[model samples]
Structure formats: C-alpha cells, structure tokens
Target: MPWIEVPDFQPRRPAQAKAQETRAWYSIKNAASEDEAEILLYDEIGGWLGVTADEFVAELGAITAPKIKVRISSPGGSVFDGIAIANALRSHPAQTTVQIDSLAASIASVIAMAGDRVVAAPNATLMVHDASGMCLGDAAEMQKMAEVLDLISNNIADVYAAKAGGTRDEWRAVMRNETWYLPEDALKAGLVDEVMSAKQAPAEDEPAQMRARFDPAAYGYRGPAEPERPKPGPPPARPEPAAEAPAPALVISVADALTETEVAALRELAQAHLDTAPLDPPATTDLDELADEQPDDWAASLAHLTTPAPWGQALEHLTQTPASSATDA
Candidate 1:
C-alpha cells in the first residue's frame, strides 16, 4: 500500500472531555438541603461563557442546606457579574461561610464579603481595586462611563465598609491603591474572620491549577509580601491615665449629601446610560422601552450599576434568615 497524506483529519476521542478540564466554570458537586453544601468558586469571576448570576442562582437554589461552604480561588472578572453573584450569595437562605483557599483578587474579594464567616488559608491573598470599565464613544460617553464607574466604586467601597466597620472613604483609599492583603492583614481589615492554622492548612494549589481566564499577575501582584521586622529595643514605661476622664456624649444630626431630586435625576441618568451604552451600544433607546422589555434583568443591571448596599443587605438577610429558621425549626 502507498503512503497517503490526510487533510483535516483527526482521531475521535473515546470519551468527552470533562467540563472542568475545558470549561472555565463548573460545579464540583451539587448539594441538597440535608447535605453539607460546598460551592467551589475557582476561576474567573465573569466576562466569559462561565459562571453568571443566573447560573449561580440556579445551582445555589437547589442547595437548601442551612449552612453552605464556599471555597474561592479566582483572579476576578466582569464587575457587572461580580456584584450579581455577590448579591445571589448574600440573598441565599443559607449561613454562608467562605474559605479563601488561595487568591481572591478584584471582584472576587467583593464576593468573599458575602460570607458571614470568611476564613483564609495561611498563605491566601485578597485584593481590592476601583471598579474598571472600557468605553468606546465620544467625550460625552467617556464622561458618562467615568461617572458610572465612580458610582460602582463607591458601592464596592460601601460593601467593604459595611463588613469591616470602616468609613467608605477609607476603603476607597485602599481600592485606589490596589491594595493586597495577606491572611493576617485581611483579618485586621475585617476581610476575613480567621486565618487557617498550620494543622488546618490547605494543600498548595498554584494559579495554573485553576486554568482561569483572568491573570492574577495583571495587577502586578507579588504574593503576600511581609513587612520589615522591627529592631530590638528596651521596653518603654506605661503612660499614666489623664487626671480627669472626659464624659461621653451622644448627638445625632441628619445630613443630606444630595437632595432627593438630585438623587432621582442621577439614578435616571445612570439607568439611561446603562441601557443604551452599558460599555458600548447603538446610539438610542428609550429607558421605559428597555425596562419594559426585561424588567428583572434591567433592574438587576441597574442595581449593579448604582450601588452595592443592596447586595450587603441581601447578605445580611441571608445570615439572619438561616439563624431564624434554625431557631424556629
């Protein structure tokens, strides 16, 4: 027989590739109400054909376990989807516990905030930065996007503040600097409840193991760099208390940062911009038309665009709802 050359020919596989081996997003296992639920959020946050709020809701809704454990290792993805997933976790009727097995950077860190009790492995990492977006349009459109990003950033900062008991401005500063937190730093910043002890240390799983979409190194990450050690010095004497202790006083003042009308106008503007040019789109569309076409989707997108407090509220409810139900049962 003469040797023949084949064109565009390939051998068939004996079996289909596992979803995890190819897909950027996949559920390791599904849990029922009675089972100890475990959700593995390992990979990109969004902006691909991976996990979405709808998928997360579907998977999470099936698991009615009183307490749910979430293991996270992601470089982060779409800000839009990030907030949505965070909200879903927050609203779930389970006592959510998050374990940062390795890295939770960008929006992944925001999702971690949904946990009632978050624990990070000894060498785990967390990062936060201002919400980012890419716009394609004239100066006006760019300005519109900048304004929207500001709102989104503020909302993210609020999530951190709500969980960590810090002012939004303080969190904003950290985001501005693209701050990264080690396990100990995360605990002090209220990003995590505890750091895993040596005995409880999780096995090493490098970033490549995830096969995720986003790159953790994009942020120029250098792992958890340690602070310089202090030089040895003599112990100082303790200072004495003040001669007279000041009496504590309480006062309440109501302040309006923006008038009601201004807020409504800003919200309407945000909605209008998001519908037609959320990132980039055709020139025109009526706000009412967009809302009427897909009200739930529109509202959810609006919620993500406007602020993050609603997500926080959902997490708060999830935390309390499970406790209340357990007590009632």
Candidate 2:
C-alpha cells in the first residue's frame, strides 16, 4: 500500500469543517437478535474527529452478526483511509449490504462498491470524480504529488470499472467528467443492485426518513438535471358574428319650391326620427293638428313618430301647401 504524507493539508470548506466538529464519522449498532448489524457513515471519511481506517475495521470485525448493513451519507475524505476502509468491508466474512441513505460522493462512493449488494434510496445520489490532493514543496516534490494523485485516481477508476462493467479507461473518462447519478441511473450503470422504492419499508423506518445531508454545491457539483417542461400549444379560434339587415329608407315628396339638397336633408331627418320612434294612429292625428297650429309643436311631433309609413305620409302632407292656399301664394 502506498501512502503520501502531506502535513497541514485542509481539503474542506470552512462551513463543512465547522459542521463536522462535533459529529461522529460513523456509528455501528449490533442488532439485539445478533443476526444483523447496522453501521451509519454520515460524515467526512477521515478527519480529526472522524474514524480512522484501523478503528473502523476493528469495530467492523467485532460484529458477530451474519448480516451487516452499512448505510452511507458522506462527502468523502482521505483517499488512502477510504481505500483501506473499502478493502476491510470487501474482505468481511458476513454478507455486507451497503445502502446509500442520501449520498455517497468522491472516495465514499468507492467504499459503496465494496458491498455484496449495493442499494440506494429513491432520492439518494452518487458522485464520482478524479482524486485530488494539495502539495506544498519544491517543483520535484509537486511533480511527485501529481503522479501519486494520478495513481490513486487510476486505482479508484479500476474499482468502479470492476463493479460497473466497463474498461478502466472508460470509467476514468466518466470520473474526469465528474459524473452524478440519481438512484435509477446508479442501478442502470450497475453501481447499485436496487433503487429502493418509496413503497418498500425496512424493518426500522428511521433511516429511510433521513434527508440528504451532503450539499452538492459545497463540493463543486451542480446537482441533478432538472426535468424538461412541455411547451404550450396555440389558442383556439373564435366564430364570427352574423350581420343584421339594414332598415328600408323613407321616401317623402316635397313641393317644387324646395331645392333637391334641402329635400334630401329633410328625407334623412324624417328617416332617422321614424327609425327611433314609430307613431300610433292617435299620435299621428294629433301631429296633423300640431302642424297646423304651432310650428314648434310640429318640429317636436316629428321626433315622437314611431312607424315609418305613417310618419313619411304625415311629413309629405305637412311639407305640401293646400291647392287652394297655393293659388293665394
């Protein structure tokens, strides 16, 4: 096993570091029945407050259970430490079932591959990327660090290829691209045996309810792709309304003294008045008397007429002088 010692290396964001200050890296609980055991790995892989590779392996060895279930939700840390932990899980005599509770990212994702059967929650996520490390030394030392990182990356890629059915180079390409997988994608890629359906409940449902603690943005990932929305269609066409018939024009014969333009104007005014107000026989008789008595009353009577036929006859009668009166003029 090759190990690189880089003192004073801090490869975590300030917020992430602050959050993990009091949290345990992992927890093991042996079932009361003694046939099954469960381990929760819910923090960074290796840190000052985190479990070391040796400590994790020792605790794993103590479990006498025939079946061991490892539930993981980690952002990953310490490549060498994670590699050791993975190897320990792989070599365990018991049937090891690894379940991704929320996330398994970076080296933690590598550890997930050690299980005999890997299972992921419907909302769980997996991320794989090339191994990274910081080097503070001369040019020659930096070059050596770069080479070591490449070697580590290649080793991690080999583990993925072995589990997921692909060539080492093929997986290396995917890792370089920093591939992210939803539970379904992980199953399709052979990274997980099953994507645990929401309907399926475990013996203890507490772990199933655990929300995703790993933030992809904190680790430089943009998270899963958003679902595509359907485009809107064009609006429906409206029917045109039916046209109405025009009212018949009223014709009035005026005396020869009236000019053609004045007669036409009078015809228009009478037609407008008749269209608005149609007169009965009683109103028409009153209008005849009004025309003889008061000129103002005759003007007002034209506006009260309803029927066009009677109003036009009355208008023609009012405009014409009596034959006897015309001889006197």
Candidate 3:
C-alpha cells in the first residue's frame, strides 16, 4: 500500500501550560545542508495516539528528510498504532535515528527500535514485556487467546532482536523478565548503541515545562495537505467500556459481553495456536452487534468470529475488562 500522509492530532498548546506527553522536538535548522528530519509522538488523550488513519507517518513524511530522527516522550497508547508506525519506519530507506529522551514503555519501545540508529539520553528509559489485548469469551474462548499471544510474542521479539542484534531466545528471555531498562542498563543489554549526555545534544536546557512539546503545525510540518475539517456527523453512540473487576487470579468472561459467535472465534483462535506457535487474537467488536447477526446470514458481524482472526494481533493492546458485578453499579 502507498504511504498515506495524514493530519496530526495533538492538544493545542499555550506557552504558559506545560506539554503533557511531548518529550521534545529538534530540527537540523537548514533544509538543504540538513539531510535529517524527525518524527514526534506526544498525544494527550490515551486513545488514537492523538493521530488517526489519515495522520499516520505524519512526521516521517513531513520533513522531506533522508536521515530521520524520531524523538519520543509518550506514556504509550494502542499497540496497533505503535506497530503500524514502527512498520512504516522499517520500510523507510533512509538512515533512521530513534532518540528516547523520556519513557518508552509499552508499544513505544517498538517505535524506538524502528531506527537504524537507536540512542537514549542519560535519563531515558525503555521497557519490554508480553503483548496484551482485551479479550472476551469462556474457557474455550481463553484457550484461543494463548495462541494469539504466542504470535504477538514472536513479533515483539523480532523487533528487539533486529535492533539489538541479539539471539531471539535471549531477547525473549529479556521480555519474559518484563523489566524496564534505564539508559545505561539498556546499553549494556545491547538495546541501544549509545547513551548521550545532555551536553551531546544541542546546547540549552530543555525546560521541564517545554519538553520541546508543540503541535505538528507548530513544527512547520503538516503531514498531508488537508483542508479545514468538516463538522462531524451526529455523534455515534459510544460503546460501553464494560467495567472490569480488579485483576482476578483468573480472568473470567461476562456472558453479556460474549455470545455464540464470539465464543466460537475465541475457540478457533485458541485451537490454531500450539504451545509454541502464536496466533493473532480476533478483534474486540460490539458483541451486541455480533449477537444480533446470526452466523449464517451476517458476514461482517456474526460470521466475523469464526473467520480467520480479524487481525493477526489485537489493535487494542489492553487487557479484557474483567466482569464487574452489581456492587460497582
């Protein structure tokens, strides 16, 4: 597929208020003399990475850069987006540089590894762990999840190993431990090539407040040339975030959230996965929608379950909401 340039989504900034997730932004200062460009990830709302389908690869495309540098300061959002952008970077032909100035946890780590050159500021951090996503269904349902998880584990391993130049088993061991590595330690683990001191970066104090945060427009980059946004159509009804119980020793599925087709999907996904093989879990859609469509007639909804997993890895990289009881209500 051709790369689609999209508009950036970021919280508007006033000089007075501090930027929430933006770590910082820097440019080569000269377009001709400077062959370098940058990608920034700092979305305020946890969802969407503050970017949408149209906005993907916004920064990477904006600067017309041959040597791309991505500076990250994000808490992390949907793993789907993280991997999407990371995959985009992998496809990049230029010399890519990924700089971690702050925390790169969860999916952010994938983005960090997209770089051919990965560097971290002294205080920067990196985290690795098992891939996770919300799930629905019963015992048979959960059995399927194991397979999908196995695949996600491999994908994650491939990323770290490619960047770290380490064996996959050793890398998997690092993820199994699920530890966050600070700059010095991460370098020791071969996750990064160098940890540059503040002096190594351009001369100036990055205000804790500024964090060099700015909207995509402020950076002199507009991913794709788009006209003013049209007014939104009537707001679609929001889906309920079915209240989840505290992490149970075992994750139990709520009947209201799972129906026949969903149950079957979970079963198929699980069956596909062997002890070592990883399968991608099906997507979490409105089970209510699935329930209404009988499997025989509905291709998109009910039948969606039994089909090959909707996606290889879950787009929503979070845990399934455990069933919440009446007391919470």
lDDT of each: 0.74, 0.79, 0.65
Q: How would you encode candidate 1's per-residue C-alpha lDDT over 97-205 as one tens digit per residue?
A: 9999999999899889999899999799999999876777788878887888888899999999989988989989999999999999999988899998968534475
Could you tell me every candidate's TM-score relative to the true structure?
0.52, 0.55, 0.48
In TM-score terms, which candidate is top?
2
Write model 3 residue lDDT over 1-329, tens digit each, in one string: 11112125455555333232322321223222256665666542135334332245554555566777777777666666678778878887778788888888877887888888889987898899877655567776576676677677788888888877877788778888888999999998888888998686544654442454545677788688788988889988999999888785865665445566655666676665443232544343676664464343345333435654543333222243434323334
By lDDT, the better pick of 2 and 3 is 2
Q: How big is the positional error of residue 241 in model 2, measured in Å on the Cα after superposition?
A: 99
- Badly placed stretches (over 4 Å) of model 3 are 1-34, 44-54, 201-329
TM-score of predicted structure 3:
0.48
Root-mean-square deviation of Cα positions for candidate 1 versus the true structure, in angstroms: 58.9
**Model 2: per-residue Cα lDDT over 26-99, one tens digit each:** 87897544677999889888754333466678778888788999999999987877898899888889899999
Mark the regions of model 2 whose C-alpha exceeds 4 Å error after superposition: 1-23, 48-51, 201-329
Candidate order by TM-score, highest to lowest? Answer: 2, 1, 3
